[model samples]
Target: MTKSAIRIALCVALVAAAAIVPAQAASGGAVAARSRSVILKHIAFHPRTAHIRVGGTVTWRWRDGSIVHNVVGSGFRSPTKAMGTYTLRFRARGTYNYVCTIHPGMTGKVIVG
Candidate 1:
């Protein structure tokens, strides 16, 4: 095959590989998650409580457009954003509570064990 054909094949192969791979959190954290995502929509956390093992990660994806939100927990906090992502890696075993300061009664927790 021509060099051009080989280059095209390589590009296609790369794209396919990327598609099959699980995406890491924005933090670029090394730990993978047992439970991958939490959706923020309609002013609430979809699961409300997330469970993961120690060294696992939890990613909060903001889907509520134009309405800003943030995750403020014991030792970590995310920037107040309307359209972005927040990732937390649980290093210890226990329950970590979080809330969106802008919205009262909007709360959740991460249970790591």
Candidate 2:
């Protein structure tokens, strides 16, 4: 075969490989995992309760009209902060509880499966 013909064949093979590659396979490992957010308003977590899968993350945002609130974990003293946000990743299959230190009556829970 001619040298130019060999080069052209190689180029065509590369083009075919590129065209057959799945887009997802190229960046699948670097893609960011999906996450969810919950709002804290009216001195309480808007949903008050929720369920999520392991490896998922939940972010708590202070709503504009919300009263001061916090997300306190067990054995952890002093709630995080009011008008502030906190994120927790559910890495295990279990239930976790949190409450507002500013207001003892406000509470929330997360069930991970």
Candidate 3:
């Protein structure tokens, strides 16, 4: 096949593959489930703490209206940009402590049992 035809065929294959792949699987399927959500308000985590089974997911929703908040764990830090929501999946059975970067005093914990 000619070079141009080969490129066209490759592009078509890529597009087809992309269309067939599920969005979640394409990203990463390790984290699955809508475990729970903790809203950020009054510069504190609404629930303060939560418990979930291992392999569960936790989503933090920033609800201070216009203020920016971040979910920072031991070594993981969510994007600093204003995010309406952020998610973290626990794969191990342990306690995880997280705090809001915008307000250090605002803290929360997650217990994965």
Highest lDDT, which number?
1
> Could you tally the backbone clashes for each prediction?
0, 0, 0
Task: Give lDDT tens digits, candidate 1, residues 62-87.
Answer: 99989999999877889999998888
Per-residue C-alpha lDDT of model 3 across residues 4-103, encoded as one tens digit per residue: 9999999999999887677756675544443888988877887998887788888888778777888888967887645577888888989999887778
RMSD of each: 9.6, 6.0, 8.1
Tell me how far the alpha carbon of residue 87 in candidate 3 is from the true structure, in angstroms, after superposition.
Answer: 0.8
**Candidate 2 backbone collisions, by pair:** none
Q: What ranges in model 1 sit over 4 Å off?
A: 1-33
Candidate 2 residues 37-94, lDDT tens each? 7788777786777677777787889884646666787643334555667777777778
Candidate 1 versus truth, CA RMSD in Å, comes to 9.6
Which candidate, 1 or 3, would have the higher TM-score against the true structure? 1
Among all windows of 10 consecutive residues in model 1, the one with the lowest summed lDDT is: 24-33
lDDT of 2: 0.73
> CA shift at 111, candidate 2, in angstroms?
0.6
Against the hidden reference, what TM-scores do the models get?
A: 0.69, 0.60, 0.66
- TM-score head-to-head 2 vs 3, winner: 3
Order of candidates by lDDT, top first?
1, 3, 2
**Candidate 1 — what's its lDDT?**
0.86
